[model samples]
Target: MSSHLLSRPLLLRHLPSLSFPLSNHRFRPRRLSSSAAVRPPATPEPAVSVAISADERYGKKQIISVTPQIYEYILSNVREPPILRELREETSSLRGSQMQVSPDQAQLLAMLVQILGARRCIEVGVYTGYSSLAVALVLPDSGILVACERDARCLEIAKKYYERAGVSHKVDVKHCLAVDALNSLIQKGEAGSYDYAFIDAEKRMYHEYFELLLKLVRIGGVIVVDNVLWHGNVSDPLVSDPRTISIRNFNKKLFEDKRINISMVPIGDGMTICRKVLQY
Candidate 1:
């Protein structure tokens, strides 16, 4: 096992927002230790929308602490293209402009896709294509990345970025509820055909996505869900925020799930990675 949190050096401040689309969302807590505890998501969506803890993806997870050198090394590996940089600026320039994915998380997304050798993949959300670009860059040349996003403005940015990245040919950006898109795919008997999937859309509907993802990904395939840490509120029994409660419950369910092997890593906010192991 790695060293304890106390054994680490002085952690640096968040990457100085080097890119236009970088953010430590409002749910972020501005304190740090060798280990950092994340804040949960507070965005209000339709009650019927997916019930994921959006804050958790953007919120920093309670880290047990890795060395500063380790942290820097991870950040240095993420590539930031000039076209993506310009798109980030354009999206953030809008009113109520709310599109951002940290550099580390985006790079991590790429790593996951490559490691999985993902071909048929899905992304529940695509904000400016940073996440889409990350995954698309690493997918096999013949791979297809289906991005389901509801916001046209965000999709516009995502499209622009993918085109700029020159991988637009490999991506399919659909404007619709992620669940709806999956349902349509299921109708075509596309379940269990995808090799990897990422969920970062409406938080409340996370459970729904997980259920469908299990069907879409074959055994040994993986489904990576973002934002399960929910900032620091998940552990607080008294914090009755519905979103926080939902995430807490999901984490519990994932652990008991004999269908997959799970790991809740302190990578970003908290990424719950489940490698499916069962049939059904």
Candidate 2:
């Protein structure tokens, strides 16, 4: 069994000490648009290796976590796609580093799009555009993916990815706070138009995003939210961080939300997959 369950509880991870000063060791984004928490570049490890082992440290049956070979393959592909080699080099030159959707995650998203035959998609965060590319890759030529990105700096990187992947025609980038972008789209009669929506922007707005997404995504469409675990602190009662509490509360609400069928997967911090079951 895969030891690393995506739904597994999040734990605060510690980094190895190095000459890089403490402040320097911190994963600070060079720009505010770097929405993802930057981690140390992954060292090449054995293919399909264990990532997190569920041992008896807690005196219970453990789950052995493994990073699939596909993950490494995706990293390798991203590191070497020929057409976009120059664009990627420029992206790194501008962004200072690479942050992308793992190959497993990319394939997972793509499979969903293809299997569900999603012709329209909405993505809340564009980041380096990996997620958007993932969605667009499986879409029909007529499909459209609307991506909301507030940071022009990061969106620039995303644009390159879209171009390199030859999917720019399928993606429309909206530069604005996600909420405003969604509000305007709805105003323009884009409501209930999306077959799939992925939400991964600012955490505190998850609830609001859901409300807006519900209107924008048609009944029977699905909405996916990332980072619901917030690095394992969602259960810490004493910690009332707005983002964490908001997620925990959202999870609670989803469980009781008869309007949609939900499955919170333990994938990449956590992905709450909700398929709208009720027509508004």
Candidate 3:
């Protein structure tokens, strides 16, 4: 990997932080085309008085809500490879299509891989292989990705896409629980060997996955956790569902963790990108 590609500044730029001030760098503002520019309504509508909800009054507005039109524009702007587009289209008809990562998220994952110049990676969930294919496509010919998934059917779909993308050799599919696969990797003395990892499996086991991944990934390696926001339910006091609670607790744990630096981004539900700062 080129030294410039793996520069600390480049890696830290993507991983937001408040603990340390980021080095000042000039960034060119994106210029939108005339059609893509946001315009106010042609006709001004009369303002109507509406009672503000408690949540609305006190809640912080950081990330913008992605409306359907906005999402369509994002999809049009993002560059999706032909094979990934085909896989995403095919996965949409499946039963758990919603579980798959969005195209923009996939693009982000691929960019992370390239930015880090990662050679070895891991994917805790492989739903229809959309994200995995994205990562595999960006990895070099010698790069390898250990993909763990229990669903045989989903794995089969992933395998088909991997073959079509001609990156089958780069993916090592493990048809077992994520915990077992992660443990197996540790037992084989692969601790702190991976360059990157992505977790999108069982919500309840997120903490466990983090602990294991911390050991498997070397110091400075990156771990990306998906669905951290749980459709905005994590902050809702009324929603005490098991899955929501699990994700909420996981987010808290990540916040308190000092071994890794984290940035929770509101993209594709939500994703927390962690960079290991200390070894386990």
Candidate 4:
């Protein structure tokens, strides 16, 4: 808790002087007797300080309430390169721009790719290639990203930006349903070949994608699922919408799943990270 909201001194300074009529007897303050003296004010609790960092790796459940001011502060301090910033600005005005991952989330994805020493990556949804661009930019010279997306219009925008970012050679854009692309990878003996996978496709198909991605990533490899909170609808029991139900059920299944070590991180739209610990 911060005194910035309303401090005692500030409150006292703004408070108006009061005078009451004799007729308002009920509203008069009651004086305490000597025997029933008022208790001394208790000591104030220490305020918890939070440090915002773009370079540091976040914990599994680490989260904070993101007010507009806090969001702005994060954007200001976060280290985003010029090419990435330009791409973000270009994608911000699209009709389905909301589908693009936040800059913080994109930065985290890029960091994860480097931290994991990932050489081959898979992106389940490629909405204007925001995430794809992020991951591709951080990858090594030999690194490659297989981006699976169904929307041609979005892919066109993503291709333009990818080329602009100079990562077009690294990203293999598959303009088809994510499931088909994932299955094709498996069929081509590419199972357990990838180091990381990012899932951000259709909500109803999360479970299906998770199963396929698990097989695609090798043991000890990481898979990050985005929008696990579904705009905080999964936790609200009253929200029985199709997407909400799908996300809720998907979360339950992930919890019960024993093949991987899971961490449901509270980041952009709530990302759930799963590390494959067993061989299929």
Predictions ranked by lDDT, top down?
Answer: 3, 4, 1, 2
Model 1 Cα lDDT, one tens digit per residue, 75-106: 55556555555665565566534335556677
Candidate 2 root-mean-square deviation in Å: 9.8
Task: For candidate 1, report its TM-score.
Answer: 0.74
Please say which candidate is ahead in TM-score: 1 or 3.
3
- Candidate lDDT scores, in order, read 0.71, 0.69, 0.81, 0.78
> Which candidate would rank higher by lDDT, 2 or 3?
3
Evaluation by lDDT, superior candidate among 1 and 3 = 3
lDDT of 2 by residue, 55-101 (tens): 65755554434343333223333322333333433444444232343
Candidate number with the higher TM-score (1 or 2) = 1
RMSD of each: 11.7, 9.8, 11.6, 16.0
Task: Sort by TM-score, best first.
Answer: 3, 4, 1, 2
> Which lDDT tens digits does candidate 3 get at residues 1-280?
2344222111111111111111122222344579877665698533322243457677644433444334444545567777876777677678878788877789899999999999999999997898999999999999999999999999999999999889999999999999999999999999999999999999999999999999999999999999998867797899999999999999999999999999998777789999999988
TM-score of each candidate?
Answer: 0.74, 0.70, 0.79, 0.77
Q: List model 4 lDDT by residue over 76-99, tens digit each.
A: 455666676566667666777778
Clashes of each: 17, 6, 0, 0
Which parts of model 4 have CA positions greater than 4 angstroms off? 1-64
